[model samples]
Target: MEFGLVLQTDPPAAGVVALMRRAERLGFSHGWTFDSVVLWQEPFVIHSQILAATERLVVGPMVTNPGTRAWEVTASTFATLNEMFGNRTICGIGRGDSAQRVAGRRPHGLASLGRAIDAIRDLAEGREAVVDGTPLRLGWVRDGRLPVWMAAYGPKALALAGRSADGFILQLADVDVTEWMVRAVRKAAADAGRDPARITVCVAAPGYVTADDSPAALAHAREQCRWFGGMVGNHVADLVARYGTDPALVPPELTAYVEGRRGYDYTHHGRADNPEVAFVPDGIVDRFCLIGPPAAHVAKLRRLRAAGVDQFALYAMHDARESVVEEYGAHVIPAFARP
Candidate 1:
């Protein structure tokens, strides 16, 4: 399976660029960043630097929402990057989250997200597409290619991804959830008369490599990655509101932990010490994140790959940013290298 590195465009844009460059040297094929402009820096602006610095690392938002910018503008930015940097960019988009909510708006519905995907892909690929009843095309784009990947957690979003998106991005790494979502997307693709094998499956989660599997070390690793479960709970809460916690519709493994979730504080959205995520239990952290030694990570990755995961995007959001990347580059990545 291919490997990718996920980061938040935190600051000193150069730091983000350096990490991407380092990841590229270490064999990460893709570099991703959080795109909540209000919470963090603009990812597209930083993506340019990342693309320019790295030789072969593809860069894009771990997710940008359709509501934040005009569809044409988003397509134009991507087209410009691809024009300068070879078609080495992929768009991983989803319904609004911190990007929108922090700006005082609700997440856009799946319908809007679905349309944005088509319009952005078509325009960036040098094709004409109707956006808001107007025919729009990036006239400067020549042989430009942008694979639009949709991040989804609900059934409707999943169905839309299967029927339309070039890839599916699942933000967590639970094997059962990965298996279920992959089957859902692929089945939807088949039912929609599309080739299921053509869609790329990317599983992204916080991966913290510990020194050993000792309980104390494991506990520290879990605390650092606990923020992820809360980040994911923001989406799960939405699912529960719509799907009503049905095990048949939404897996209990996903919904059960969020029962104690009172609410979230965007100020601490993806931070390691987010007090708001204290309600996130250790069990949820263990299942949602890759927290163990390299061998343990390889074992879970093997299961994920066997479950049809084509790529695993490691979220280096904790304190051991460089160390985890180095470990994955040295131990985890080589374990799956093709001869």
Candidate 2:
């Protein structure tokens, strides 16, 4: 399976570029960043620097929303990059999240997301598509290509990812949830007459490599990565609202922890000490993140691969960002390297 590094485009544009360069040298195939314009810097602009710095790192937004920019503009931006560089660009998109909510807008629906994906893919690939009731196409694009991957957590979103997106991005690393979502996406693909195996399954989560397996070390690891469960709870809360608290529709493994989730604050959206996420217990943090020795990381990743994960992207949201990347390159990555 391929490995990726996810970032938040936190300032010092140069630092972001350096991280991607290091990640590429360390064998990470993809470099993703948060696309929330207000919360972070513009990822598309940063993608240019990342691509220019790295030899083969595929850079894109961990997820950009359709509501933030016009579909035509989004397609053109990606197509422009593909033109300058090779077709080493990916578009991982979602309806909308902190990017929208922080800007005083509600997240969009699947219908809008589906429409944007079609338009972006078509336009970037040199085909014609209709956007905002007007037929549009990137006239300058010739052999330009952009693969649209959708970040999803809900039933309908998963179905949409299966039927439309070239890849499916699941933002947590829990085994049961990963298996269920992967199966859901693939099954949707089959039911939609699409080849299930063709869709890429990317499981993204925070990963931290530790010194030992002792309870104290494990506790520290969980504390650093606990923010992930809360980040995920934001989406789970939405799922509950949409699909109700039915464990049959959405696994309790996902919904159960969020029961104590009183509310969320975008100020601490994806940070390590998100106080709003206090409800996220140690168990949820352990399951949702990969925090252990290299061997342990390799073991869990192997299980995820067996369950049909095409790639495992590190959220890189904690303090051990460089350490995690280096350790994965030195040990975890080679452990799973295909011969």
- Per-residue CA lDDT of model 2 for 77-169, tens digit only, reads 899999999899999999888999998999998999999999999999999999989998778898988999999998899999999999999
* Candidate 2 segments exceeding 4 Å error: none
The model with the greatest lDDT is 1
> Per-residue lDDT for 16 in model 2?
88
Q: Model-by-model lDDT, in order? A: 0.94, 0.91
Q: Which 10-residue window in model 1 sums to the lowest lDDT?
A: 245-254
The pairs that clash in candidate 1 are none
User: Candidate 1 lDDT (Cα, whole model)?
Assistant: 0.94
The per-residue C-alpha lDDT of model 1 at residue 24 equals: 93
Compute the lDDT of residue 73 as modeled in candidate 1.
Answer: 95
- Which pairs clash (backbone N, Cα, C closer than 3 Å) in model 2? none
